[model samples]
Target: MRVISGTARGKRLQAPRGTDTRPITDMIKEALFNVLGSGIGGASLLDLFAGSGSVGIEALSRGARQVVFIDNSHNAVRVIRDNLNNCGFTQGFELYRNDVFRAVEILARRKTKFDYIYADPPFTVEAIFGPLLETLDRTSLLAPDGSLIIRSPRRMILPLKLKSLQEYRVNNYGESTLHYYRLI
Candidate 1:
């Protein structure tokens, strides 16, 4: 995969050589950023289930001030590190090789808030969808006007509204779907 725009545009990123990590495709990435528009500039982002760190790197390239990447796979973390180094990103980022939920809790405890949070868990892990949304809704990890974007299989059923988060938009790209949620 490669960066679609901004300072690191055209920089080819390395993905883990296995099925465990599914990097976002350039087309979908472009569409996502298009929807995000210029709001990405100077934003702090949380990238959950950050396989290969593609989405986080894209945010960095597009001028995000900071990005925190979380994933449970050693290989994914290694690939993310190599990709970040390759793009000459020496700062404004954090990589955590831990479970996404636990990392969220730690970030919450630190009173961290992000302008945007992107999650792309494996489609096979459908069980995580509910708890993930609930945890995020209960924590202070999301800024008051921040958004949470989740990528999942188009066929997977996700909640339209939670206690604090409400689904505002849904975009479909082939078999994948991007669900956008915001604080109610």
Candidate 2:
């Protein structure tokens, strides 16, 4: 994987040796940054289930002030660390090797709120999104006006109560899907 833009544009990143993470394609990354526009400047971000830390690192490169990455895998953590170091983002990042749910608990207890929250859990996690989102709400980790971006399959079902959702754009790229959401 590689950084999509900014201070560390084009820098190569390392990833776990298995299917633990699906790095975002450069095209999608570019499109994401475009959609994000100026919202990223000096914003704080959360990359839950952050595999290789690609997305978080990309946001940081593009001007996000700080990014907190949470992942439970050893290889993923190591890769994220190495990639952050390589991209010179270590100074602006926090890498937590813990369960995404538990991390949410801690961050919420700390009253940590962020401008952006990106969750790309494995396809196997599709069923837990409701509870997961509930956890986020209970923790109050998401800023009222903040956004949430979830990368999941198009076939997956989303809660209808999320109708307040500002946007639910979907893009199909090969076997994967990118789902974007924002609060109204």
Candidate 3:
């Protein structure tokens, strides 16, 4: 995959050597950043299920002040590290080889807030969608005016409203869907 825009535009990224990780396609990534607009600059982002770190790398390329990447897979973490190194990104990022939920909890406990949080768990793990949303809703990890963007199979139905967050936008891209939520 390649970065679609910003400073690192046209930079090719490497994906993990297996099907365990599903890196976001360039088209979807482009559309996602388009929706994000110029607000990405100077923003702090949380990338859950980071995989190849494509999304987080894109945010960094577009001028995001910092990005925290979390993933549970060893291979995925390695690929993410390699991708970051290849892109010459020496700073403004943190990589965590941990479960997304636990990582979020730690971030919350540390009072770390992000301007945007992006999650793209494996489609096979349908069971995670609900609990993931609930966990994020219950935490202070998301800034009051920040957004939580989830990428899921188009057929999957996500809740429109949580206790503190509400769905504000939805975009469908082929078999994938992007759900945007913000504080109510």
Report lDDT (Cα) of residue 70, candidate 1: 98
Which residues of candidate 1, in runs, are more than 4 Å off? none
Which candidate leads the pack in lDDT? 3
lDDT of prediction 2: 0.81
C-alpha positional error of residue 6 in candidate 1 after TM-score superposition, expressed in Å: 0.7
Residue 84 alpha-carbon offset, candidate 3, angstroms: 0.7
TM-score of each: 0.98, 0.89, 0.99
Candidate 2 shows a clash count of 0
Instruction: Give me the runs in candidate 2 sitting further than 4 Å from their true place.
Output: 162-171
Which lDDT value does model 2 have at 109?
77
Pick by lDDT: 2 or 3, better one: 3
Better of 1 and 2 by TM-score: 1
lDDT computed for candidate 3 = 0.94
All candidates in order of TM-score, best leading:
3, 1, 2
